[model samples]
Target chain A: MRRADRTLGVARGLGWFSIGLGVVELLAPRALARGLGLRGQEGLIAGYGAREIATGIGILASRDPTPWIWGRVAGDALDLGTLATGLGRRRGGAGVALAAVAGVTLLDVLCARALSSRRERQPVRSFADRRGMPKTPGQMRGAASDFEVPKDFRIPEALRPWTSAA
Target chain B: MRALVWHGKQDIRCDNVPDPRIEQPRDAIIKVTSCAICGSDLHLYDNFMPGMKNGDIMGHETMGIVEEVGPDCRGLKKGDRVVIPFTIICGDCDQCKRGNFSVCERSNRNKDMADKVFGHTTAGLFGYTHLTGGYPGGQAEYLRVPFADKTHIKVPQSLTDEQVLFLSDIFPTGWQAAVQCDIQPEDTVAIWGCGPVGQMAIRSAILLGARQVIAIDCVPERLSMAAAGGATTINFETESTVERLNELTKGKGPEKCIDCVGLEAHATATLDSIYDRAKQAVMLETDRPHVLREMMYVCRPAGVLSIPGVYGGLVDKIPFGMAMNKGLTFRMGQTHVNRWSDDLLRRIEQGQIDPSFVITHRIGLEQGPEMYKTFRDKLDSCIKVVIRP
Candidate 1:
């Protein structure tokens, strides 16, 4: 697959991740707040979920999600800061939640950087409309670098039964 | 030279095996430096696989310093430190041309036997059973690497063996698993098994942008390891995995599910596992695919199910209809090891990720036999075993 497709794939995956987490935050704000040691802050958690959902929607809608991806990076910073507040409460699930947030922050930063790099480079072919079709040998062959097979390249006697003819 | 030889089931010995020599024109003799005992090696140790002969030097995850090269060998010379991929490929073959080196057509020496069993022959493997070409393995003082130019990945001296050693199998296998998931930006990946490949898969999923990873296993240490790798863990013994997963994903289920535990899956409590064990003991089945059924059950509609685990022969009670009905994308196979090694090495060098996090035990070569049992039984929280010869 092309690099653009991979980047887009990751972007899309992040969007869905945002949506998934948003849904959880919205429906189970109490549990999430408890896990993050933000007890009695269920309303705030739910609001953040709404914001996450909106950013996720924006990313999914835009062909160029670089700005929204940057938004996610910003949101990740906010999350880290919020999780940092709960670091003092090492008991309960606070530590686990903090670790999880840190991990997700790293991913957000990586995605942001990847999209930024791609935006700076030449425009890549969009995989959006390329309906799933298996590439023929001709299509796949071009990317293969040209290299000469040694003139003496031959299957050894012991390994011949396992090898097929070139 | 001393090598770890498999005599029979539950029988491995560090014996005085003849040192490997360059036997093929494209071969090179590598003075083995670091080798690992893989989870798949347990399949042979348990006598689960057919065609394993006594005295077979058993190892595939290996790195060594090149000692000699044959006349036809290219791109390698003596004194080069290299990580050897388990799958052997003839680089000039059609499969290799397409970068599908794991399925290289002209690499397996016993292609007909494989063709008869699997309907097609895959690439030859090092130190695996004859079913995969029976090339003498690298769990020895020296190894004869066939297709040296294609199979061996040279590493610079600056990097330690632990950093690049896994390019041989598990690292790529896990990366391939994550790639095969066709992960979307917000995909939640649920991985079964917290072994080395599973840990690597968890990391790969995170690096590839998995929003959340849910790891399922029964072992406490493995679960803690998965948690350390940033995955939420569910002990299959204490909690209901399917129920918890459903709750975690709000009844929609995770978008990607990876089964890293293959044929020797255990669940003494579940009826499915009991049936699998009874059937397997009677030779009625060759595999126990409990994790596969769970994946099909818990994966979201149109989700991807990637199997990095190894399974041989036929499995019974698979939820094929459920998988088809859900429109799940299934991707499983022997890893195209050579395809991903270079990029992964670049990632390692750039500090994007460290591959050494999975190594829990490192020991001398003589301890190979006991360590195999320790790893197989999950003693000492053994996650990965690397042997220095």
Candidate 2:
């Protein structure tokens, strides 16, 4: 597979994953906060969920997903910072979540890098010499003027020029 | 015989299939020498056009030498070199007599189903949907051509396959698009897409003596090719197509607009395009008519909008009122290949234009499945792919 296509496939998978995870975080932010021992931060968690959903939609909808994947990488950093604060209160769930987020962050960074490199690798190709005409376009202009337009295909007679000057 | 067969969406396989046979008196079988992948075939590859069944052979642009002829086939014999037009036609039909071969009344074997879907049956097209006759196509080692007496264009041995191959479809399709415009000496023709048909339309407009030919496309290589064929190119990604066209025509808009980008109109370029994608994903709409909308909005009053692009099923948000008020003449249909093939063949023989310049990739029939994806994705700067079976 081409690098661009491979990376794009990965990006699409990640986009679906984001939407799924965001739905869980959004509808049950209070339960998620309690499990992570960050009970008071439920509102902040829900806001982050909305950001994830928006980024997911951008990645899925846009022709180029590079910018959206970079947005995902930035969101991962914010997620890691939030998880770090919960480490003091709960060691088990918060530690596990932090490790998982870090793994996903690595993937986001790699996908973003690969997508960027693919764009940079494509050089603009020129076909200036592939002019199918026997002569210059200017010289070839009106070359078929001798061929008559079929009667059925001709424009209305009223639309035709009445005189050379007109 | 190995032929490219459609199993499902995005699933084309080179499978060993039964060789075709003559079922009718007028049928002739040809040993296919060369064939091509057309832009319309992409509609089938993406599974957009309906009525396609599994195991249908896939291809349209084809040419070869006659290997066998049925008893009633008087115009063809063994060893005759011929290019098979994509549209199957019966010369005795009223539409055929009027030179509207694309809408021939009798060629489509599945006319009842087509009548329900399209009001009236169009021509039976090779390798297209079953609604157009479900006839087997020419992407294999041998093909069975029905109504072969009137359905083939004989070419002289002096011209190579590359020079006359497109007389079956794109060359005449593009020619008909420009002819629909009825271009005048002072008119400017603006073509959309810059794919093979767009390239041909550019050259056609220039040869017919249009004052200016402008090609709008986002692909750099395609734009460069259009420029090489005597057009002022517009890269739609970096500039506004409407604004550029208006400026080129002194704010009156081009007198002629041709839509070569049909259902798939670069689905993320503008807000309307994105809306089209979203709707298409949910099955709320069937075609993306972004180019249609743009042409309607920007064409000069009393101008012509000639469409060689193919569109299937429902389209949403067309500005019919705007077009109606503008007095724009709309001309669009499948190309009547036989109607214009003789003239195009003469042009090829006279060195007026070389249709072979559009081909970017050539491969054997077994490689057709992979090339389909490459062409669809615009990978490796592919503009056209020709297959030697």
lDDT of each: 0.81, 0.91
Off by over 4 Å in 1: A1-166
Expressed as tens digits, the lDDT of each residue in B1-389 for candidate 1 is 99999999989999997777778899999998899999999989988788899989999999989999999998899999999999999999888998788888988999999999879999999998898898999999999988898888989888899889999999999988877765544667899998889988877776666667899998777777777666888999899999999999889899789999998887344678767765776689988889999899888877778898999888998889999998777878899888888887877776666778778789988999999987887766687899999
Candidate 1: C-alpha lDDT: 0.81
- lDDT tens digits, residues A52-95, model 1? 98678666645467777889888878777776777687555767
Q: Over all chains combined, what TM-score does candidate 1 have?
A: 0.70
Fnat per candidate: 0.00, 0.70
Candidate 2 is scored at a TM of 0.92
lDDT of 2 at B24: 93
Angstrom error of the Cα, residue A83, model 2: value is 6.8
- Chain B TM (all candidates): 0.98, 0.99
Candidate 2 local lDDT, B70-125, one digit each (tens): 89988799999999999999988999999999999999999999999999989999
- For the candidates in turn, chain A alone yields TM-scores of 0.69, 0.74
What lDDT is obtained when candidate 2 is compared to the true structure?
Answer: 0.91
Listed per model in order, the count of residue pairs whose N, CA or C atoms clash below 3 Å is 12, 0
